[model samples]
Target: MTYLYPQIIFSKLFGACLLASLMLLAPLTAQAEYGDVVLNNRAEQSGMRPVIFPHWFHRIRFKCKVCHTEVGFEMRAGANDILMADIIDGKLCGKCHNNKIAWGPQNCHLCHSGLPGLKTGIRGGDSTGGPGKW
Candidate 1:
């Protein structure tokens, strides 16, 4: 039993080391898989979490034109310079996010989903589908 004790201790220590290595690398893997969008342009500056746009969810419902063309949303993140006033005045997201169509802008967290309290695993699609295309 004395000889077995040393082997058991070594095995336990090796398992712990392996676990620590995996833990350190876990975040990097997640970032690669979820490198969808992290719109932090004005979010952190304005003392808010960056908007994590979920292109996957939106594309599933509305065609790209509904936003990129009609709504005039830029393909890149933070390019629009969206402001709270614009939304309230029915300019940017307010166009559709109004209570009648979708959730109202009053629901701040809906669009300002960059809030730290939330976990945004949302991903977006590339420029594949467009008007008269798909």
Candidate 2:
């Protein structure tokens, strides 16, 4: 007969519970459409409305690695130095928004529709103090 230690059994149970919790929370995180990121680095300076990039909307079509790795967008909010000239020259946003893969910058209001001086960062917040609000 073989005997298992109590600590070993506890660890195995803990690991299983953690994995299950993550699986259950995955869908909730995906439902957060309000997690928009405000890119006001140059919008206000350039006389345009700030860009309200919905992180959730983009996540549905592409994975994080697509933009954060292959497309070269910094993972941190407001970290990438995205410029209109660079984008128009086929860099940063222009990688896909070049009127081919996706809509081009011609429709400025489509992206640059955030309020003035909105600052660069996430828009959603845990106002209710609930778990996983944002």
Candidate 3:
């Protein structure tokens, strides 16, 4: 009976330790899996949800220089203060997101996809900055 008690206690402790480790790892995993940049500098005031820019999706078709260099986009978040007026003027994302090249900026909800149940379709948990596995 005494041996059984110690075994039971040890098993419970091991289970608790495993649970704690998993909980701590969850956030890191989520962050890596979804390397989405939430562009919300002017979204709320403009009466829209934040734009969730999924880097993985873009990287699949375009090189880094295409947008960061050719498009004059800053390498940091919120650095490009993009506005609807600028977009209509054929600037920033309008360079490609236009109806002729990609989807037009008129489809506002497509980029401003930060609603309550927005899903970015990103997967995996390795974020070493290499070609991210989706």
Among these predictions, the greatest lDDT belongs to: 2
Candidate 1 residue-pair clash tally:
0
lDDT per model vs. reference: 0.65, 0.80, 0.74
TM-score, every prediction: 0.58, 0.68, 0.65
Error (Å) of candidate 2 at residue 46 is: 1.0
User: Residue-wise lDDT of candidate 2 within 1-134, one digit each (tens)?
Assistant: 67889999999999989877866665555432466888998899999999989988889998989988889998778888888889889888889899998899788999998878787876564333234333
Cα lDDT of candidate 3 equals 0.74
Off by over 4 Å in 2: 1-32, 127-134
Candidate 1 positional error at 14, Å: 31
Q: For model 1, which pairs clash?
A: none
lDDT of 1 by residue, 4-115 (tens): 6878999999998987786565444453223355566566677776677666667778998999999888875556777778878898788888887888877766556664
Error of 1 at 43 (Å): 2.1
Model 3 over residues 47-97: C-alpha lDDT tens digits?
Answer: 887788888888998999999999999886667788988888889989988
